[model samples]
Target: MTVSVRALRPGNRSDAEAFARIRMLALPYVFFTADSVEHLTARLHPDAHFTALLAEDDGEAIGTAQLSLAHESPEPGQALLNVHVRPDRTGRGAGTALVQAGEELLAGLGAHKVFSWVLDEPADRVFAERRGYRPGSTAQFLLLDLAKAELPPVPAPPPGVELRTAADFADDPRPLFELDAECTADEPGDVDHRLGDYGAWLEETWRHPLLRHDLTTVAVADGRPVAFTAVRTDGGVRYGTGMTGTARAHRGRGLAKLVKADSLHRARAAGFTEAHTGNDAGNEPMLAVNRWLGYRVCAREVQHVRELG
Candidate 1:
């Protein structure tokens, strides 16, 4: 069977659905859908140079790749590529073909390094090592069975602070965006981030199809958002925490925990039976909050880096 890779068709519902299906089949823990796929392709910053590629065997898609330059990072020449093949279709060359195509795109963009997430599985690790990729920091994908797990009571905000949903800022979300930028800059990750572009944030995040604004809890202190936990729904029973963070000044106040708990409660009440989130291994504070909320690590994936010569 001839394996070929090509860019996902813009504005095509079929291609978007196929891409999302292959991705979800390969990695079900992350939140994604046809709408989410289209959103990524349409809303990404132009500087990001993002491209979604589909891998096919004789014209039938079997894998997907999302590759882009780390445009928002302080560092330069760094690119990201994540390739996932359908679990049932793995013995073929589709994965390798997709990876080669993705790397070619990144390298052509003048990227010096390519970082990819490799699942914590024997076959997955060997696949990367054979391709010259070296494993780096690991991340844990946690899952909470909201229907059966006991969720903690939402913490009461301290005096002068109150908890509200993202919907509360319906007319204006800049405060939430500001808080998100501040917390994102300090987030634990391999690539340092810069969220200085409000326009990009509004398109890529605020209008994202999966973001459940009404279920996303925000901590307001004196009329400003100091902490927040954003929620993403699968249009069904699953909900995922997109990000949870507190303003640097508000650290150690359990605001992260407070916001996350409230978001979870709202998600459960809204009929989402399963919840998912991921944390960098070194992020102890957020991990602790997840544990307190009864989320258990369901899978682990390591970031693998390969330098382009």
Candidate 2:
């Protein structure tokens, strides 16, 4: 069967849903929905040059590829192209077509490098290797069964620190933004990101559709956020921590664990049955924290990098 790739139409419900379905089938650990797809595509910074490509086979959507310039990276001409094909549709030409289309788009944008995250499976690694992508860092996806696992009790905050929900700063979330920026700069990753764009942060992270501010927990010190566990809910029974980190000065005091525990307890009490999070394979600290929280590693993915011609 012949496969062709085309740009996904924003605001088209069918397109969004089909993209979401493909993503869920290929990478169940990550969170995605039609609403999130639409929101992200519509709210991307103008400089991002982002596009969602769908691979169709005989009038049926069977794969997806998200291609974009790393507009927030300090390095110029860096691009990202993550392709995922439906499990049932593997071995078809869809994956190859999607990759070809994505590369063309990135090359047209003058990208000097392209990165992709592929599941750490034999076939997936082979597919990337055959196309000149070299394996980079690996990350683990974790799952915690809120209904069955035994979660550690929320710990008491240190004397000077106070626990609060992200909702507490509804009037002004600049403190949280500052903390997020600090943490993001220090996160273990292959790319160096420049998150100094406050306006873009407000649009991309603060106002995102899946961000559950009410369930997100923050640790405050001296009236400023020192640590936080950002939450994303599917409006169902699943909740995921989008990012959990502590300010560098406040590290080693276990504030991240405290806020994450609080968030998990609150989420379960509010009827969330499953919780998910991801950690870089090199990040032993966060991995330990997740283990202490009863999260078990469910899957692993490897990043592949290629220098564009």
Candidate 3:
């Protein structure tokens, strides 16, 4: 059986569906949708050189890869080649083929380094190592059985603070954008992402299909957004926090916990039976917060990096 890999056909409904399906099957912990996949590939910045690659075994897509440069990073030549093969189709050559196409594209784009996320499982680790990639930081995929987990009671916002949803900022989201920019800048990760392009953020994140603005909670102080727990839903019973953080000025006021708890409670009330979120293993503060929310670790993934001359 010969496996052929090529760039995804943008605006093709079948391509988007196949890519999203393979992603959901291979990485069940995360949420994805065909619309989101199409939106990302269509709206990506030109400098990123983003390509959604598909590996086909006998004309059927069995592996998917998202190749692109980390354009927002201050570092030069930083690229990503994240490959995920359908679990049942792993033994075939599709994974390798997809990876080769990704690396070739990145190298052609003058990338000096490439990063990927591999499942912490032995086979995934081995596959990455065999490709000359070295393991770096680890992150956990956590799940909370909202129907059974004992959630802490939502607390009232402190004096001069109010609880609101991301929907409240539809008129003008620059405040939320500023808060996201600050918090994301301080995140602990192998790659540094600075959300400097507000217009890009609006197109790529704010208007994203999976973003549940109605359920995303924000804490405002003195009529300004301060902390937030951005939420995403799979249009099913599953819900996940896309990003949760507090502004630098509001760190110790328990706003992070407050917004997260409020969001989870609302998620459950709205019939979302399962809640999911991820955190870097080194983020002790967030780990503590999730523990308080009754989230248990379900899976772990490690970052793999390879340097190129």
- TM-score attained by model 2: 0.99
Q: Which stretches in model 3 have alpha-carbon errors above 4 Å?
A: none
TM-score of 1: 0.98
lDDT string for model 3 (1-309, tens) is 889998888689999999999999999888888988998898878889989999999998999999899989999899998999999998998888888889988999999899999999999999999999999999999999999988999877888999999999999999999999999999999999999988998988899999999999999988999999999999889999978999998898889899999999999999999999999999999999999999999999999999976
Ranking by lDDT: 3, 1, 2
In candidate 2, list every pair of residues with a backbone clash. Answer: none
TM-score of 3: 0.98
Candidate 1 worst ten-residue window by lDDT: 183-192
Residue 175, model 2, lDDT: 87
CA-lDDT, candidates in order: 0.93, 0.92, 0.93
Q: Tell me the RMSD of model 2 versus the true structure.
A: 0.8
In model 2, what is the error at residue 118, expressed in angstroms? Answer: 0.5
Candidate 2's displacement at residue 133, Å, is 0.3
Global lDDT for candidate 2? 0.92
Candidate 3: residue 252 lDDT (0-100): 83
